[model samples]
Target: MNEQEESNKKQKTSNESTEFLNFDYEFPLDAANVIPPENSSIPEDLFTFVTDINDIAPEPPLEIVTRINSQRQQQQRQRQQQQNKPIVPPNQGVYTIIVGGKPFRLSWESLKSDGPSNFFIEYFKKKKTRVMQIDRDPDIFELIVRHLRGYYIRSTDDIQNQSLLYDATYFGLNRLKKLLQEYSYLNVGGRVFRLPWTLFQKDGTHNFFTGPLMHSLLSPHTEEGNSPPIYIDRDPDIFADIVNHLRGYTIHIRDEMHRKNLLKDAQYYVLRQLSDKLLTAQQTVAGFGEGSNAEVLLLLQDVRIVNMLPPKVTNLSIPNMLISQDWSLTQIQYKRVKDGTPHTLLVQVSDLCMQIHKSAATVKLMYEMNHADIKKMNSMANMAKATRGVNMEIYIDKYCAITIDDNQVKSIEYCMENDLIDTNWEACTKCDLEDCQMSRLILQRAICGVHLVDNMITLCALRLEAISSRFRLNLKREFLSG
Candidate 1:
């Protein structure tokens, strides 16, 4: 009875211990992190066969996950609210400013002196002693403080400059506002821009002296911050186009006026590549080819010079003689005309010649009787009319060439890339009357008898008609010459 009873009691106790250790629900196993103690009785192969916890265990129920996330969010919101609470400074002279959930302690005297625009001054007028709270960026507010303390704020980025400017305006910092307007990186016609400083300092391969001129315009902001903008008077829209060109962007000009305006700015700034491009565009618009290769020849025959000045000398007529190309014919009707003023006769001649060299393009040609040459001719005009059948020849290079077709000028070649052809007025003063007279004296030759004709106007008109007909016939042959 004693042995059976003892065995049964022992079995009951072991059963009780096993039942205490076991539960109705299974505890989840973390296979990856689970490690066995060295003295553990568990088999090593049990761990080897273990799978990843995610693979073995299912995720928590959706409601439980949602509730947990909600609790976490609420905790974060509480922390943020605590952080946003206004901070009070301990010192009497210092005031605390809460900005963007950050506290800044500034001197009350400094705020009163430099900051605290009308907004803050009203609060001060109420004599309320409370921490200030602003709904602005704390980083930019620091810049405002720096500016109030008379520190130079060299803002090279447009965004940063704008942020600081907004804060300055809210604070009613008049000095800072003015400085920001003036000392901004670039101010083009009241349009403020803060590009990378290196852009203005950088030299371009296509433009001539662009960087230096633009650089000279933008003065660095001094500690006082009162520097005026260099391009305050310039056109912002055109300047924007220039900026695009500088930034390696292909900018399309909308119309001819825009191109012309930009060209003017480019020329003023000495942007040679841009100017050349615009000039070529101008020629293209005028219906002339990119580069004219045509040559022009002008000839004057049976030339006559007559003096209409008061008779102070022996003769009032110069005989028919070969005249220099530089010698402009004296006005037949007027005693004296201004140099640039269009002479009726010269204008008639130019129009007749242009008609002969007619094309689709507007030919830029001009003929004018020089007043200086007329006066000098008057000095020599008081002489006998010597008749020797004088003839004069004048040549102008590439004056009337028309663009062949649109296909030829599809792509514009910039002058910067190519050598510019010398397109200046060329004249040969070989047959000067004064020089010819001197030569005659040196050679001791007798001059030919003068043939003076009072009705010279009719003869000149007839000669012009003959010359126009000749030009019309030879127009093709003349323009085709290289």
Candidate 2:
């Protein structure tokens, strides 16, 4: 163990340390399989240090550099060309359109943006011709051309309106179609009913009113004018109700007569929804629950009794009758006892008549009964008696009096003989009262055994009975005296 031995040993240890620290760790084909060294004193910065591969640059071929520079120049030229390209104004160009043997000059810019216009423009451009033929109505084409020129159209004729719509559809003029649909109005029975075009063109089943309206709006013969209205042959009031419904408003039909008319018109027009609405309205106004027949018949009986009264009597009014229960005979019977006389009794009858007439519901009921079918009336009468203990005889007798005028007795007899009364009562009932002499002679010859005065008395009695029943009256004493 000498100085030489110690130095040699130290040198061997230093060499081993250098070899371990320099560890030429090549990235293995499967680096995941490499095992980490247990422990080492190598500085962390030395392990993280990266070599500058970019510092060792190699010269590229001249041909490759030339090709790359050429591509860059080509892209620069393209960008300059794009920036310098010309912009054509929309209104700058002109085009010719041949529609229905007529040539129309249109703006190319205007035609280029629209469906039909664009189609024709492209067609002409492809054919390299300025003149393109369109097999559309010249008038309709003119309208489209005007619209393209920013002119609004207002049409009233059904044929022209329809043709315009057709042309719009063919040409794909949605804005024009929408304009026409938005502005169409109807003139029905001398009354104008305006509605939104969308309502008539809704994509489903339509009512009688809308069907005709749509047809009229779309008919080729339909004319276009300045805010023109399509003429319809229909009752104005009923048409108004239909229009209200289409407009999404709640139908507020107050009068039963109006309701009936609306119902009839709805049926005629095949407005199923409106018909359903009117039917519901009828039931509601009649105060009859759904499917209840007896109360309706009873109301009809009351109506018949009221209709029998003379027009003068029906028009009379009794103030406070609706609020005052004392007006009933039960309350007034004892009061009238001391004042008993023919005059007093007549006054009481007059008051009772006024009370009945003053009731709007009662008046409506009476009108319904007056116009009710004869056979239907008889059936309703029978039904009423069976269901509600109503006296059908009273209703029958009233109907005979009010409906059968003395002057028209001859006509009535003729109608009965010919069975025309069953078919058309309105025609049979309408008679010339001024021709009384002729009517009286005819009545005497035709209805020899019919006593007109007795029938009148019976009709009066039936009415009195109704008044008594309605007001809960104990009018037996006054009624007997009258």
* Winning model by TM-score: 2
Model 2 residue 186 lDDT? Answer: 64
Candidate 2: where is the Cα deviation over 4 Å?
Answer: 1-92, 98-103, 116-119, 133-139, 150-152, 156-159, 170-175, 182-187, 190-192, 197-206, 209-231, 241-260, 272-482
Model 2, residue 380: displacement in angstroms?
Answer: 9.5
Which lDDT values do the candidates have, in the order given? 0.43, 0.44
Write out the backbone clash pairs for model 1. Answer: 319-386, 385-450
- Could you tally the backbone clashes for each prediction? 2, 14
Tens-digit lDDT track of model 1 for 362-393: 11121223455334333333432223222111
What does the lDDT come to for candidate 1? 0.43
Candidate 1 clash figure, as a count: 2
lDDT of 2 by residue, 1-482 (tens): 99999999999977766656676445653553243345656667874547565655677899999999999999999999877654433565677888889999887766754554446555655565567787878987887887887776666555576567777766767777777776555667886554666664332266554576566555434346332335668789778777777677877778878877877786677765555445432221211365421101112212222112121121122222121221111110001111221110110011212111112222211111123433433443342222222221111121222222222323223434564322211221222333222111001111000001211211112122122132223332364463
All models, RMSD in angstroms: 24.6, 21.7
